[model samples]
Target: MEREIVVIATSNTHKLDEIKEILSDFQFDIKSMSEVGLGGLEIIEDGSTFEENAMIKAKTVMNKTGYASIADDSGLEVDAINKAPGIYSARFAGENATDAQNNEKLLNLIANVPEDLRTGRFICAIAMVFPNGESIITRGTCEGSIGFEPTGNGGFGYDPLFIVPEYNKTFGEIPAEIKNKISHRANALNELKSSLKVYLERI
Candidate 1:
């Protein structure tokens, strides 16, 4: 039997690859918006929260393709900065800002903050919208502190600055194998997998 075509509502290749690797074991042919002929579709993320943004993206894509679509809205929330850069993480520095620029902005904003007070978390909210109007939303968070400077050049965005106290390393320094297990996106995807099992079995 042919696998089900599940669309991932994202244009970022990095995020698409990460999610694809995580969901590879499932019996579905996961695809991106461009691959499914809807590359031009854009949904405004006017939502104030992660869940709302994720749902908006997922539902929009699902409606466009009439297929099950998944979307994620994730960001870093720094306690010292009052959890700012939450939903605006992507554009924290400015519109169309580079990852390095955003990281620089974040570091500058909390430059005076002490090490112990640099606590924060990576938050991910995943939403899935099925063709039948049924949907699922799950959230995951990974706690850590912001490093004074960027570290290894492995992961993207704030990965180089996010220090995992337990590992004594940032996500950028850790191996992909390890990150796939503990990342906020990984955690949320794991939960989605569990619920997806029931849906997959039904089909």
Candidate 2:
């Protein structure tokens, strides 16, 4: 049997890796947008919500490639700051902000806030768009708080400062093997996988 192809509409290497790892057991062959010749494709993410942004990317990719595609919009939301840097997590520092810069900015933003009040969460919304205009969306969130200083160094983006309450460790401190099972992306992908199973069976 030939393996089905599913293009993940993302250029962020970290996100691509996480999605691939979470869906490793699936029968479909997953390819990053760059791998599938959509590297230069730019889709504007002006959606007010994660789901809308995810849909924009997925639909754009599916229309351009004529293949089923999955896209996710994820970010860190801090309750202390009224959920700032939500959709703009990537450009939190600036348009060309580096991961380190973004992390530092986050740390400084909540530096004065008390540890007990530093509540936050990571949210991920995944959208799958098929060629026939059918689509499915799933969302997941990892509730936690922000650390005053960045810790460890494994995951990307704001991982170093985003604390996982259950483990009492920042995502950067958590190993990939363990992070893959509990991260926001993992949760969203798990939901996506369930829908993919039904979609695969139908087709």
Could you give me the TM-score of model 2 versus the true structure?
0.93
Question: Candidate 1 at residue 77, lDDT?
Answer: 99
Model 1: residue 180 alpha-carbon error in angstroms: 1.7
- How many angstroms is residue 40 displaced in model 2 relative to the true structure, after the best TM-score fit? 1.7
Per-residue lDDT for 111-147 in model 1, tens only? Answer: 9999999999999999999998889898989999999
C-alpha local distance difference test of each model: 0.93, 0.90
Candidate 1: regions farther than 4 A off: 201-203
State residue 13's C-alpha deviation in candidate 1, in Å: 2.5
User: Between which residue pairs do clashes occur in model 2?
Assistant: none
The most accurate candidate by lDDT is 1
